[model samples]
Target: MKVVIAIDSFKGSVTSLEGSAAIAAGIRSVYPDAEIISLPVADGGEGTVEALVTASGGRFVSLEVTGPLGQPVAAAYGLLGDGRTAVIEVAAVCGLPLVPEAARNPLHTTTFGVGEMIAGAMRQGVRDFIIGLGGSSTNDAGTGMLQALGYRFLDKDGQDVGRGGAALLDIHSIDAAGALTGLQACRFRIACDVDNPLYGPEGAASIFAPQKGADEEAVRLLDRGLRQWATAAADLTGSDIASVPGAGAAGGLGAAFVGLLGGTLESGIGVALEMIELDRHLEGAQLVITGEGKLDGQTSRGKVPYGVAQLARKRDIPVIALAGSVDHGAEALNDHGITAYFPIVNGPMSLEDAMDPAGTRYRLQATASQLLRLLRAAGRL
Candidate 1:
């Protein structure tokens, strides 16, 4: 019997790798020699670095960089075993978690830390890169990151615009003279999943600005800044990135990567699957297991489990999911090659108790055991 445990992180409580390990324990209890393969996954959001490392034979390089609120923070980027490809998650530097609740505003956040992460990797002989743009705390339209990389944004006085989206509106022109020269010699891929443009009603400000603590009026100010910055980026790079697809991802960090860094935006799950060699793992497997923190209507979108399940279908492998909570639309998961879906909770428990650190592992183990038993009978293993 062959079973593969492929699950994303439980989020806030456990890691995807750790969750797979716990699930492996239960599978072992059922079939001591079940030939189980553990493949931890992430959707290019949090825990993406570890996911790439576990998925591919990737190495880590750490450095000191600016955090969300302009504070110094230690961050790391990854290099796959191929030795040439770099995997960088911007959240490692300028994510919402680093900024305190009272200080989480788009007006002041910057992607300079993200730029520093890339710059640090470029020094290590790394060339090709897969940048994961998610969970950002800024709405700077890529100006901060471009400034860090040598595309100088100057105010009317011809002086540097310091940092943040507020400064973008003061720019009269941009100078790409001092940016990282090596970027011109390498291939860059940005992993993002949004289609919002850089400005306007459904653009970066109106859609994502509020999440970064921008009030109604603040969102308007941020939107105004993006329009000016977008024009400047076009003049500097000669690329129309403002209205581009996914330009609004990570508060316009995706646009920065595409416009300033000369990178192309790609799907995060597509990148993860290729690096992990999931197609290779799916061959001849009797069953595949995948899940995330939750399964609902959104699961039909580009979530990790859904993408993995799609791959499983091509190989005629049945998929089973174990989620933190299963919603009404979960039954639809079966249409995507998932033979069955199940929730991890045992009966009804308080949302807090279900999320307790002590209870998560036990519940996951029990859930996996029950799932294995059902698969055993139906799978004829």
Candidate 2:
């Protein structure tokens, strides 16, 4: 039997690679002769850089860059096997995790490190970019990133503006005279799942700022600042990015890419699958097994398992999904090309105990073995 395993991370328990290995172990225990191909995958978020880089036989390049707080931080970007494609996760440079809860403040955070990472990749002659826009700690409308790239955000006095979202409120003129010239030669494909706009009730600050440590008053102020920058960005780029879908992602970094760099916003899973060439690996496969930390109605919204199943269905291959726990609405995934779903949890156990790496590995192996045994009994093997 030819089976392809492409599991996502189990989050805090096992990585995608580890999950795939566990499943493969189970398959081997039952059918030692079966051909099992393990592929680690992600939806272009937390594990995006590592997933893409590792799967493509790429390497990571680390450097010091400005953090969300204007402090120096060590950041890394990926160079894929193609040698021309670079994968960058904005979160790596200024993600929320880098900031303590007490210090989280979208108003004062910046995306300068994001720009620095892109520039670093460019310096290596990488012109094709896959930028993951999630888990940000800033709402700067990407001015910080623009600044790092040589775009100048000028106040009424022609003085350069300071970092943070609130700073965008100053009457401004965006000066591109010093912007990186090599930017014109690059192609940027942004990994974005959300569709929030730049400013307004459903915009970045209003919907996401609170989680980034902004209070009600700060949200309002940041929203107002975003509106100001939107108007200015529109005047400078001739594009009303404030209203664009996904323009609010990563605190307006999406706007900077779409409005200024001409990047395309696409589903994170789609971008990830495309980068890994998942379709090519599905050929002639009897079955495809995939999983995530949790499977729910939300999985249908472009998660890794859903993406893998969709592609597998196109080739008429049966797909089985494994999860830590399958929630009520997860049954809905059956209609989305997943032939069956199973949880790795064997029986009663605390959430913490179940998440132990060694325990998870054993459970996954046992589950896969039993699944194969059942298939054999049904004469499907």
Candidate 3:
């Protein structure tokens, strides 16, 4: 029997690799001769860098970079085993969690640290980049990041416009003359899932700014600034960035990557699965196991389990998902390629106890063993 285990991290509890090991151990208890392939996976959000790096035998590079509020923050990026590929999660630098609720205004946040991270990786001879655009606290449309990369956003008087969403409205021109020379030789693959535009009613500010600490008035101001920035960027790059799908993700940082950095935006899970080469490992697997911390309506939207199921479905393999908690909408996953879904919790317990790493591992192992026992009795193992 062959089994492929690819589970995502359980947030504060078990990690992807750890969860996979637990599942594998359970399977081994039932079928000791089973060939188990464990792969670490993430949804291209917070744990992206760690998952990809650990799975690919990569190293992490940590540095102090400017935070969203112009203060110093410790940040890190991943250098893959390939020696040339660097994976960066925007959340690691300017994510909302890094800012307190009282200080979470998008107008004052910046992505300068994201650019600094890229520059730092470039200095290490990394030319290929996989950037995850999620959990950002800025609505600067990448101006702050662009500024750090040498693309100057200037006021009408030709002075530097400075950082944050507040600076977007003051921009009169964009100067690419001083931009990093090596940027032309680099290739960027952006992991993005949202499709909001750059500005307007359905755009970045209007849709996502409120959660980043913007009120109605701040949303209006940020939207106006985004519009102005989009126009200036169009004048410079000659591309209508405002209309691009996912151009509004991560508080308009997606626009900077796709419009200014010449990066291509793709589904976050698709990018993650491609990096891990999930298909290659699924070749002759009889059973595939995948899951995450939770399974809900959002799981079908470019998440780890959904991505794995789709690939397994192509090969006619039975895919089972194991999550810490299963919500009402998780049943919808059955139509999307998941053969079955199971929750690891055995009985009623506190949420904290359920999330305990050792407890999660034990429950996962027990569940897998029982599932395998059922399959064996049914002559399906």
Among these predictions, the greatest lDDT belongs to 3
Worst 10 residues of 3 by lDDT: 42-51
For residues 1-381, could you state the per-residue lDDT of candidate 2 as single tens digits? Answer: 899999899989989888888889889887899999888889989889889998899999999999989899998899999899999998999999988889999989999998998888889998999999999999998899989999999888999899998898884789988989799999999999999999899999999999999999999999999988988888898877888899999888889999988899999999988878889989988889999989998999999999999999999998999999999789888999999999989889998998999988888888888998898788887
TM-score of model 2 vs. true structure: 0.98
- lDDT by residue for model 3 (216-328), tens: 99999999999999889899989899899999999898898989899999988898998889999999899999999999999998889999999999999999999999998
lDDT of 1 by residue, 18-59 (tens): 788888888888888889888877778787778888677778
In model 1, which regions exceed 4 Å deviation? none
Minimal lDDT window, size 10, model 2: 165-174
What ranking emerges by TM-score with the best candidate at the front? Answer: 2, 3, 1
Q: What shift in Å separates residue 311 of candidate 2 from its native position after superposition?
A: 0.8
Off by over 4 Å in 3: none
TM-score of 3: 0.98
Give per-model TM-scores: 0.96, 0.98, 0.98
If the candidates were sorted by their lDDT against the true structure, best first, what order would they fall in?
A: 3, 2, 1
RMSD of each: 1.4, 1.0, 1.1
- Clashing pairs in model 1? 149-179, 150-179
